[model samples]
Target: MLTVSNLYVQYGERILLDRISFMVGDRERIGLVGRNGAGKSTLLKIIAGAQSPDEGIITRPGSSTLGFLHQEMNLPKGKTVLEETLTAFEETNKLEERLEVVHREVATRTDFESDGYMNLLTEMSDLEHRFHLLGGGNKQVEAEKVLKGLGFKDADFQRLTDEFSGGWQMRIELAKMLLQKPDFLLLDEPTNHLDIESIIWLEGFLETCESSVIVISHDKMFLDNVTKRTVEIELGKVYDYKASYSGYIEMREERREKMAAAYSNQQKVVVQMERTIKRFMAKATKTSMAQSMQKRLNKIDRIELDDEDTAVMNIRFPVPPRAGQVVIDVRNLTKKYGGLTVLSGVDFKMDRGDRVAFVGQNGQGKTTLARILVHQLPPTAGEMKPGHNVHIGYYAQNQAATLQPNLTLLETMELHSPPEMRTRLRSILGAFLFSGEDHDKKVSVLSGGERARLALACLLLKPINLLVLDEPTNHLDMLSK
Candidate 1:
């Protein structure tokens, strides 16, 4: 069992966690969720011993190993897929090596009844038992199995790690972590770069893993499929719900309603008491009653509801004149760099107001196709034509670079909007929850969700009938999704 008590974490003046506590029993799967900057990742790091909290105690059983998969860990290059994964069994491999050395020494001995021969035999037997216990002989097979389950083909196993993309490198890291098979596993956004098929395979592997696993992710379907419990971190505290994602939502709603009702009843009592105190005080003959009311008021505890805000993109496309049915058309579109083909022989069409979702695994030409459709990347062997009155408003997935870092929220809108639309800049900013000082804050200081909302806000300044958003909801919360 792993347990945390009085976990208080703070960054400078901001308190990220306040007296949080939780436990994970053996073989339990828990999902950690919250809004952006709600300390989900921080909590994972603290548990993994990568960060130290100001005040807390994390207790785990003795001899229990922990495997943590962080997002920003370095991977050694110049190693094949099999070699990288086999590194996880370093101790087991060393044990097997020692066993071989003992066997060789025993075989080279002349006297079979010698004390040294007996000692070697006994030591070899113990080493053999330990090797078998550690699954040393089958280590290579286990490593291959995990790598394949994570979507690496058998032919690709011999390839060098440097040949794969960043996302594939992340998968290698994941495979190494899985091979460790620690008593507890801490995974942060494990499915970020996975395709649908790979996600399904990983979910199955995690479901059968005989260890306590805690994962932080934005994928609701993944959480519901893999986790048996949901641990939500909100407002510097933790709430434990003994159910899946869907069940947790229902229970949270019920709990909110109950709290709202209780607060309403308390407000009514406070109002009635104040009214009675006013009526009696006006008489000038009920001084004791007024004093009693004052005491009660002083003793009453004000109820404050949870101030939970959901991250959402308030996107309103600027309406343009109605266009023809066909907005975009591509014929035999093909894109290639040298001999490598990113996309080839792809035929697609987008009509006006078509909200098609491009679903595929990472690095499967989804973004490449989006770029082609927007005319940002020229196709080598095909043509794209826009129909009459067709206009395109594209939102790039990497909005951080596309947006001006030096510009404030209001300034960004002013730069993109027409002069006549400038009058409504305050209202527009308010709609995106950027009122007050937030409007004056620079885009560089904004969080990922904030940046996404600002980018969508910038899109509203133009008059375009067609909108193409690539991974618009990548860093958004549940409400945003």
Candidate 2:
């Protein structure tokens, strides 16, 4: 079990978690949810001991271990995939090393029954016992199982991790974390880079694993299927619900309704008190009563309502400008790195107003083709032609990274807009739910979803006939999407 008491985290003057506390019992599955900037990731990082909190005590059993899977990480290179994964069994690996040390001592010792020699023998026996108990001998079998389950083939096991894409590198890290068998696991957006099949496999693995899991994901279906409880952080507070995401939404709505009613009743009472004071102010006989009523009004604490930050991004793709019948045509498309052909002999054609999707596994050239179509990359051996007047707007999967961190939301919006179009900035920001105080927040401080909205919002600054979107929905939450 894990218990957090009196937790307080601050970002300058803004409170991320204000005296918030919660617990994750053994074998429990928790879904952590909140708006993009609501400190969900911060709370996870604190619990995993990846960072420190301003004030908090996290209590756990001495035997318990934590494995935190952060979103951004760099895996080590110069080792084969199987060799890298073998490092997860730290206990067994240490035992094996100690045994090697004992063997060297035994080889040098002439007196086998001496006190020091006897102690070395005892240590070696204990090490072997613990190693065997931890399945040290079956490291290869276990590693292969996990690697294959995560979509790595047997042949891929011998390849250096550096040869893989960033997504696959993250998978290697994930595999190592899984093999460590921690008592508690913290996963932040684990499925963001996974394909559908791999995601489903991971969901099954998470369900059967004995460790307690706290997963932060925007996939509503996955949350409903895997998590048994939901914990939401909003405005520096936590709301605990002993149900799945769907059930939590229902209960939360009911809570909002109750708060609204209480606030309305308080307003009515305040209005009535004001009327009574006004009516009695003209009479000298009721002066004391009027003063009494005024004092009561001054002492009253109004019931605060929950004004949830559900910013609506009120915008749509701009209407397509005039273009020829055929928007783009590709013939004999091929992409290669050295001798490895990622895409070969591919042909595709897109006419005006024709919707298409290039869906496949992680390294299956979907983004490669998109880049070629957008003229970001030249094809090695293909003819990719754009029809007359075909203007393209491209949204790369990593578009969020291009945002200016030091600028405020309103400032960034203005930077992307033309001088004459600057008047529509407020309306545009409002449509995307960046209104009032949200407009003043720096781009560096915005959440993943918020940054995504802002990046897409920039696209509306100009009109184009065709839009090339490559994983444009990477960091968006369900509501934001």
Candidate 3:
């Protein structure tokens, strides 16, 4: 069990967490919910001891250990997926090593009745038992179970960790966390990189996993399936609910309505008090009442309602100008990296107004073809040509990363926007939930979702016939998606 009391965290003039307090019970499944930048991830980092709050006390038993998995991870080079995963049992492996030493010494000694020899037997037995309890003997099995559960096949177990993309790399980290089985687990946006099947698998794993968990996720069904309690952070305040995510949502609305009423009533009372004070202040006979009312008004701390984050994305691809019947024509298309062939000789054609979808396992030619169509990647053999008057707008999977980090979000939009469209930049940003102060934020400081939104916003600035989008919704919130 862990307890956080009177926690406060602030960044410059903006407050992130304001005197928030909550307790995580033993084996409790906690869902930390809040809008982007509401400090949900901040609280998790504090609990995991990776971050220190500006003011607060986090009390936990000395024996309790913490495991943290965040959005970004550092992968080890030259290590296979299974090897990397097995490192989670570091402590248990150390115990096994000590046990081996003790066994060797005992076998070499002749004084069986000596205290030192007898003590070696006790130590060896204790170490072996501890190692067994930590699943040391079955580390491979445990690691394999978690890897497979996270959507990794047996063949992938031998692949180098660095060989996979970011999403696949995330699975490797999650597997390590599950393998550790720490006393407490803190996961931030754990399902951001997971597919639906992996999410379901993780939900089942957490349901039976003994460790207490606190996860910050936007997946409604995922939270509903895995969590037993919910902690919401709104307007720098904490609302604790002993219910699932769906139940918490219903109760949160009721609480919000009641708070709205209280705020309304307080505003009316303050207005009435001000008028009464003004009316009585001009009369000397009523000076005492006027002065008392002035003091009351000055001391009052007016209630503030929670501000809703309801920024909607105003995104639509511009209609391309009239083009020839054939939009794109590909002949003998083939792509190869060294000796490996990704896409063998193939022929494809797309007419104007045609909508096509590419579906296949990862590492296939889906993204490769998308890039080839956009002229970002060249085919190893053959050629692809767009019809006359055809214009293309491409949104790559990692398009956000291509943004200039030194530029402000506003500046990035301005650069892509033409003179005639510059006036509409603010409105366009507001649609993507970036407005007011957000426009001034540097691209380096934007979250993954924010960057993705910015990238998509830029895509809508130009008119094009062929819109090639690759995993455009990967980083977006559930509502945005």
Candidate 4:
């Protein structure tokens, strides 16, 4: 079991975690959930030893290993997907090489009774045992299986990591972590880049994998499918439920209802006690009784209600300008980079106010098509025509990363927004959960989810007849999604 005891974390004056405590049993699947910036990732980082808590200890057996796949990891550029993933068995490979050397030494040595020879034999035996424990043999086959499960193709296995987009690179990292098969796995937003098919495959993989997992994701259905337990972080406190995501939701509502009723009853009792105390105090002979009643009231433990952030986001897209019957028309549209053809002879048309969803495996030209429609990427062959007076507002998959890192949150919005929209910039950002000091925060300092929200907020600054979004809800929190 992995135990986090009285984990306390603070940032500035804000208490992100207040002596939170939880334990994850062996092979337990936990879903870590919270709103954006609620310190869900921070708690995971503390458990993984990537970041330290203000005061706490995480206890796990010495034999158990931990693997954490965070959002901001940087993959090596030169190595192919398979090569990078195989590195997960680094210790295993080393043990195998040492075993070979020892075998050759044993065969060449004639002194059978020598202590040195005996020690070599002992080392070989130990190495073989450890290597088998680490799943040393068939490393390539295991790596390939994980890669394919993460939506990587056979051709992609040989391609350099840098050749893939950020989302695909994230998959490569996830594949490496899965191949490691650690005892405790901490996955942060594992489904952010995956398509529906890959997400389903991952759900099945996690369900069968013999690892205690704490997955932080916005996809409620994904959590419902894979996790058996749910740990929620809210108001600098932790709530643990012995149920899946959906079950937790129902249980949480019941808990809140009970708490609300108890609080209400307590308030009524307190009010009656106060009135009695006031009446007693009016008569001089009953002053002592009033004093005793006041002490009783003061000693009573308050039935405190859980403080929930019920602030609903006031997100409203600008009214789009009217356009012709057809918003966009594509005929035999094709896009290619070098010799790789992402989209070939694809034909699609969107009438005014027509909503369409493009779903496919990663690297299947979803983003490519969206970009081409918005005129960000020119088609290599064929043509795409816009209807009369059609304006396009595009939200790219890499929108968060594309923001200026040095600029403050408010500045980024103002820089991209039109002069007429400047007055409404703060309001729009507030609606997206960027308020007060958050507006002054630099883009570089924001979390991936926060950056994603900011990017989506920026998109609503302008009005357009056609709006194109590629994986827009990937980084949003549950409420935002």
TM-scores of the models, in the order given: 0.76, 0.81, 0.80, 0.91
Model 4, TM vs. native: 0.91
Every candidate's lDDT: 0.82, 0.85, 0.85, 0.88
- How far is 350's C-alpha from truth in model 2 (Å)? 1.3
Tens digit of lDDT per residue, candidate 1, span 1-481?
A: 9999999987555577999998899899999988765788788888989889999989998878898986555789999988988898887878878887887888789889889888888888887876775567899888888888888988888989998866688899998888777889999878866778889989998988877999988899999999989999887989899998888999889988988998999999999999888888888789788989979987999886876656454656566879899988889988896777988888888887677888876667887788887789989898888888877778876653477889988899898889878898888887776757678778875655667777788887778887777777665667766
Instruction: Write one digit per residue (lDDT tens) for candidate 4, span 223-334.
Output: 9999989999998999999999999999999999999999999999999999999999999999999999999999999999989966556779788779999888899999
List residue ranges in candidate 4 displaced over 4 A. Answer: 97-130, 338-340
Off by over 4 Å in 1: 11-14, 94-135, 269-304, 318-327, 336-343, 360-364, 375-380, 385-466
Worst 10 residues of 3 by lDDT: 310-319
The parts of candidate 2 lying over 4 Å away from their true place are 95-135, 262-303, 316-321, 337-341, 402-446, 458-462
- Which candidate gets the maximum TM-score versus the true structure? 4
- Against the true structure, candidate 4 has what lDDT? 0.88
In model 1, the worst 10-residue window by lDDT is 309-318
Please say which candidate is ahead in TM-score: 1 or 3.
Answer: 3
Please tell me which model should have the higher lDDT, number 1 or number 2: 2
Backbone clash count for every predicted candidate, in the order shown: 0, 2, 1, 0
Pitting candidate 2 against candidate 3, the one with the higher TM-score is 2
State each model's C-alpha RMSD to the native. 5.5, 5.1, 4.7, 3.1
